[model samples]
Target chain A: MMAFIHHFTKTYLMWNEGPMIWTSDVLILLTSIGILAALTYFKKWKWLWTEWLTTVDHKKIGIMYLIAALLMMFRGGTDAELLRTQLIQPGMKLLTAEHYDQIFTTHGTIMILFMAMPFIFALFNIAVPLQIGARDVAYPYLNAISLWLFFFAAMLFNISFVFGGSPDAGWVSYPPLSELGFDPGVGENYYLLALQITGIGSIATGINFIVTILKMRAPGMTLMRMPLFTWATLSASIIIIFAFPALTVALALLLLDRTIGTHFFTIAHGGDPMMFINLFWIWGHPEVYIVILPSFGVFSEVVATFAKKRIFGYTSMVVSLMLIVIISFFVWGHHFFTMGTGANVNAFFAFATMLIAIPTGVKVFNWLFTMYRGRIRLALPMLWTIAFVPTFAIGGATGVMLAVAPADYQYHNSYFLIAHFHQVLIGGTVFGLIAGMYYWWPKMFGFKLDERLGRWAFWFFNIGFYICFMPQYALGLMGMQRRMFTYPANMGWNTLNLISTIGAYLMGIGFLFIVLQIAYSIRYGERDLTGDPWDGRTLEWSLPSPAPHYNFAVIPTVESRDAWWEMKKQNRTDEWKVKEDEIEPILMPKSSGRPFMFGVAFFVFGFGMVFHWFIIALVGILVVFGILAHRAFEYDDEYVIPVDEIKHVEVGLGRL
Target chain B: MTTQTNHTGEAVHVKHSAKQYIIGYILSLVLTAIAFVLALGHAMSFKPLIIILMILAAFQILVQLFFFMHINESDGPPYHAIGLGLALLFAFAFALMSIWIMSFGYHAQLVS
Candidate 1:
């Protein structure tokens, strides 16, 4: 009764006051408190705050990132369900336009920013070091710090629903619309602080992966010889390092505009709104590739593995990804074709956008060849990869259509555009992430997700996703604009809308079973101590289940493609011995709470700015720096693995 | 960070001293001033001025990559990756700005 009342009150608070979260806030707040209390009740706080939050171990940090992503996925998915419900009947006013605006806004924001980005980051953190046969990333402390910063940012974004309003502006949070005078609510401020806080994490993550992939590869694994996933990870990191700083500056300027009344992006005080668009899209353009490139890399691995072939076009796939990264930066202006820049500008952006499809099309062909005729396993992960090509193609085709400037005018700001992006984005990036979870679950925790339930998830999610979104494309083509409250009933739209809503609810049920599937597996999943449970091709599967603190028994020499699988076939797991004599005490950085504390302080300052608490914000800034400075000088806290212990642990054999 | 197998173990030593790094910083300042002066004259003719500044920027980029970033030749594959990264940045610069400046008048209005 008490929990129900608490949920009810939270929901009431959410609907009555949480601005952008107008309707979603209630459930999210209760869930947040529930999460906190549950962790405390289970005495998991110490484990979470210590072993997870402050740990410099790449694997732990990766798990934390995924957990954060999972929680936000629920939040975002609920918002999706709500929006679908609103469209169930054309004339229904179940959710007001104000509520609807916040609903879709939060849905997009939470999905793309909060969910997809972290999921990619989590994969990078977990896989990169292990695949290279390294114990940890080049800068493990920085890796932990980055995850903490992201978590802090995510927490702040959610907490805003309780303390104040959420941003109701679109995910892009365009200028003029986002200007303080125009949006007197606290919502955009929520958007600003949350993203800026997370932006720090994103930048740090970029640097961490760059250093890890660049600095920490095992011997003989040359750049060309490195896995394609590593290449894609490195490319994506570089994009983040350069791209996110642009967003950071833009958000900071917006923060200044909102609180200190600066002129960075103002129409009133000699500020140019177009500059904001440029800044936002500069970040926004690269962001598309940032999310998808890693997934592209993942799909390549997935297709090759399931087909029992060497990746068919490795060189071309890498080249295509590299080209896609470059082209991604150039296409930001397409988002603003409606801003009336010029015909020449539109045509140029349009042309640039169309050219990208060529490389992307090449990637599709590569995956197709990988699956052409080899012994195909319809594993859940493979099923996703198989389904993704056709789905993302449809999405990509619609993207090219949107690129046509004259046609975009009709589609711009309509549900049609929304449908298009959600298709490519969800189908392309999000599905890849889901597939990744299934593919790598064994490697991450030494247990596979139950295939029976897993298959159920795959089919339900895949079919339900298309059912939910395909109709939206039709609805969009029917001249329905996005972000509206209610539509007239007799417009032939109700049936499709009803079917789409049913699809969403079914997806929700499908997702629930998936979660149960994971929980059940964690409790009773079949354990394979020998890591190559899937006959894995990568170095990661060579390691033991629940990999050791020092990943490799001894850092091994990587001499070929499919390094581990080759080593396994050659019976050379013992070859790590040749280098074991040279092994000295291995040093790993100690876990420190300073980074998490700094993240908290940054959040405090961010909140202070949101509420116009000048002194509090100032203190918050100081606290952040104070934590950073304290971190810079400490050199003595690392743990060392003695040579004797190394030998005891079969130093002759490398795990992967 | 260059990934490397250091059998010699002390493979990443650089000949440049701290004083050389300081000198590099000073040289950067002088180069920046020269670029700025060359740029001011060509403000109205941005094409030439931007060309000059970009050349200067390239010099700065190389200086940082070689001196500051220390893409350690003895270490790993990072040097080539960094070079490729720079090349990609140039591609983005050309691709993005060209789209901005060259295409300015055809079907810019999307609110039909």
Candidate 2:
């Protein structure tokens, strides 16, 4: 019993790590306590439970996802600042090499998996149903499950900082390095288990959105007539469903290798690490498209709206989007062109990678054409969209440069590679998501974010982005290898690295301005009394801002592409108003605590697995299955909002 | 309660009889048993036996799709068919690419 206790304390507690961990533990503890105290003091637990946690409403789920994404961005951004600060000067001791490894790993993982994925999902939940003119997602309860699983998985991953330790074998967790022979700690286990849980959630979300978009569009809203964002969501969902399984298989096998001594990726026993790389990139390459495609969707919507014109070549845009999706799967080998896959294999992948540039270039031209010879409004969202085009163009051009297999040998693992990705990811995905948040802010809330503050945030972030990453390209060309904790001053990387670090801080400041913008807007921003704030063209704008929980009292019949715009043009906006006699009871999925409980159970199972506590893991699995069985057998899972109540809500919202 | 509104405003009340399920179950079982028996009996050389097993597996997949998954029934666009086609295409592509890529790694003598 003593030995068991000692083992548990040593492996799981991780109390003796250092001051950095101790500070994190204290901060996390205090934050939790403060949040609990505030919730109690406000007497809002019941409100929280009924309105947010147990909600099967897609809007509320989207809001929750948005909040989580923003918080994760703050976390990920902080990690970036720390990394930059560490490399601000040669041999800076702000962080030890060991700590730097963990931070960079978490930074990449959190930014991509937690930040980008949730940001996109939040947009998916918030906009897809609304844009498609549906009341809710096709599987609302399953949607709730997906959200909770992601939340809990994120919590599980973050807690590794205070508990077992963060995964330090980079975000990819490539094998041989990630194998038990080298990394015997529980950190890699945390990475695997957390990713596995979230991966399942992501897959369910993909399936849900596919079904929702495919089947739930309003009458006459054909596939081609659907909003570009919805189309993007559909394409991204397809990619998600196809791509995420590869990640699942890769992570699961690595876990098996860690826990059960498998030879799948082990070094000595006929295990091939290259297979892991191949499988990971098979998912990984398409995964970038999955995130960025949605941003492309956002840009299309924003450009069309601000340009006061229909999107230029809408069909071509969609064809190109699908082309990118198909091509994404074939180019995973470009990620490891230098891994000695032979000339023929490398040339094929390189060619496929470059082929992506054609569709992407077409999209850039389409956006430009959308804005050409049209009245352009410079709304905050539009500003981000306009910024994205030139930024992503340069990023895409650099990406093509890196796609050359022979040249990749020079740029591989260098600051140039890092700069290229951060360019596309931040310049592309982050910028687009931020634009989406601003575009839909009034739709989610009833008020617009403060424009002046948003502009400040935008310029700082955008300028800081160029200042930060542009130098890294030069640094990469100067032969600075990535993942290095520090450098010698004689290497002449000091000036560029210093400038990059400064730019990172500026971006951090910009992020702060955004938070301030949001906070100030909540109290003093302009109210969006009219739903069509931007003179938007999509079906979502047809409904009132902060639309009632039932969304549309009567589902609007879509007549053409840009259905709402068409309705407005025809002066038929009153079609949303329904007579008292026309009101019908609406069936909505019931609020249940099951998803949250299931997330908790999965968390327990994951945590137990991380620690190799078989008994605890078994109990968790049993509880998980028990909940599933209960859910399956239970038939009464939905409730109806009576006609009278919906009428009352419509009257209150002045939609009667 | 028995009828649900589909995408096209029609109420789709899909009902399946236990007989169909039993038939599907029996067919799946027989297919599996035949594959097992052939393998266990070593009834033919490796190449032919593998080819026959592959054929049986394909048939089993079709049976499952038609019987259990109800691939043909739809109220709107054939999303299920499109999804299935895409899935099969991706699966085949992934398998072929993995083999092609891994073969190169083997040729290069990168991994054991």
Candidate 3:
């Protein structure tokens, strides 16, 4: 008992790490305390628990996802600034090499997995069901479960920094180096388990959205008539369904190798580590498209709305979206072109990788044609969309350049490669998400964000992005590798490195401005009295701003592509208003605390696994199964909002 | 109430008897047993054995899809069929490509 306790204290507690960890611990403790105290003082605990935590309403769930995603973005952006600061000057002792490794690893993992994934999901939850004219997602309870799983998994991954250690195996967590032989810490264990838990949520989300889209559209909203964003969500969900299992297998096998002393990806005992790389990239490549495709959808919506035109080449846009999805699967080999899978394999992948650019180019032109000869509003969403064109074009061009397998030998693992991906991911995905957020913010909160502040934030982030990443291409050509903690002054890399650091700080400042914008807008921004802000085209815009729970008292029958726009054009805006006799009781899934408890159980299980505490882990697993059994046997999961209540709400919204 | 009509007002509920489920369950178990016996007993050469196992697996998937998943019971278009077909295609591609890529590593002696 004493020996076990000693081992646990020495390894898991990690009380004597350093000042950085101690500072993080203190900050976490104080911040948590402050939140709890504030909630208590404000007497808002029940409200928080009932409305925010337990509610299965998709809009409230979406808002929670948005809040969580923005926080994760802040965390990830801080990691990026720290990395740039460490690399700013030669021989700078700001961060140790180990710390640098951990930061970069966490930065990549957190930004992609926690930040971008949830942000897209936020858009999905907020927009897809509304646009399709559904009261809620097909499985509202399952949707809540997905959110809680993601939340708990993110917490599990985040707390690793101060508790034990952060993963240092890069975001991919490739084996051999990631194997227990080399990395014996619990950091990789946290990475594996946390990702596995979150991956369950992601897969559930994929299945949920697929069913919701395919099965729950309003009458007359045919497949081709669906909004571009809904189509994008469908495509992304398909990719998630196909791609995440590979990740699950990869992470699971790696976890087994770590915990149970398997040889799946280890060096000895006939284990093949290269297989791990293959599996990782198979999912990794499609994972990029999964994120960017939604942004593509967002840009399509924003451009059409701001330009006051129907989207150009709608058929081709959809064809290109699916083509991108299909081609994304075949091009995983491009990530490891220099690893020498032979000439034939490399050539095939290079061709496939370059082929993706054609469809992507088609999309770019489609967006351009959407705006061509049309009135452009230059709203905050439109501004971001405008900036994305040139930036993503450059990123895509460089991507094709890197696809040439022979040329990749030179650019492999260099800053140039880093520059290319960041350009696409940030300029494409992040920019698109921000545009969508701006476009939907009024619908979400019933108040528009300050346009002036949004533009300020936009310019700072956009210009800073170019300044930060464009120079890195030159640095890559100059033979500066990524993940390098420091280099000597004589390499001619100092100037560009310092410039990149400055640009990164600018982005940090831009993020702060966004925080300021949101805060200032809450009290001062324009209220969306007319739901059709921006004269929007989709069905969501036809509903009230911040649509009441049980979203549409009577779901509109979609008639044409851009159903709401067609309604507006025909002067049928008041069609949704109904008489008291027309009102019907609405069925909604009842709120339950089971999903929250499930997440807590998952967190405990993950935590126990990370520390190798079998008893705690066993207890957690038992409770998880207990919850599942309870949910399965319990059939009274829904309730009806009576006709009177529906009428009252409609009258309150002045629609009756 | 558990099988309420959707927004499209289609009868989404597909009735199945316990007899059908029993048949499916027995068939699945038998197929699994055959695969297990073939593998354990070395009933054939390696290539032919793998082929037979693959065929069995395919049959198993069909059983699961038709009997369990109710793929043919939809009132609308055969979206379930299309989705299942796509899923099978992707799964096959994933397995085949993994083998193709990893075989090169084996030839290069990188696996050792």
**Against the true structure, whose DockQ is highest?**
3
Against the true structure, what is each candidate's TM-score? 0.88, 0.97, 0.97
Q: State the weakest 10-residue window (summed lDDT) of model 1 chain A.
A: A11-20
Higher lDDT: candidate 1 or 3?
Answer: 3
Identify the runs in model 1 with alpha carbons over 4 angstroms from their true place: A1-45, A571-584, A647-656, B1-112
Candidate 2 local lDDT, A436-519, one digit each (tens): 999999999989999999999999999999999999999999999999999998999999999999999999999999999999
What residue pairs clash in candidate 2, if any at all? none
lDDT string, candidate 3, A1-656, tens digits? 99888776566656666778778878999999999999999999999999989988889999989999999999999999999999999999989998898999999999999999999999999999999988888888889999999999999999999878889989988888899888888899999999999999999999989988987888889999999999999999999999999999998898988999889987679889998999999899999999999999999999999999999999999999988878888999999887767877889899999899999999999999999998999999999999999999999999998999999999999999999999999999999999999999999999999998988899899888988998999999999998999999999999999999999998988889899999999999989988878899999998889999988888777888988888889999877656677667777889999999999999999999998988999988998999999999987888888998888887888777
Question: Which ten contiguous residues of candidate 2 chain A have the minimum total lDDT?
Answer: A8-17
TM-score of candidate 1 relative to the true fold: 0.88
Global lDDT for candidate 1?
0.80
**Residue A217 displacement (Å), model 2:** 1.0
- DockQ of each candidate's interface versus the true one? 0.24, 0.41, 0.43
Q: Regarding DockQ, does 1 or 2 come out ahead? A: 2
C-alpha root-mean-square deviation, candidate 1: 5.0
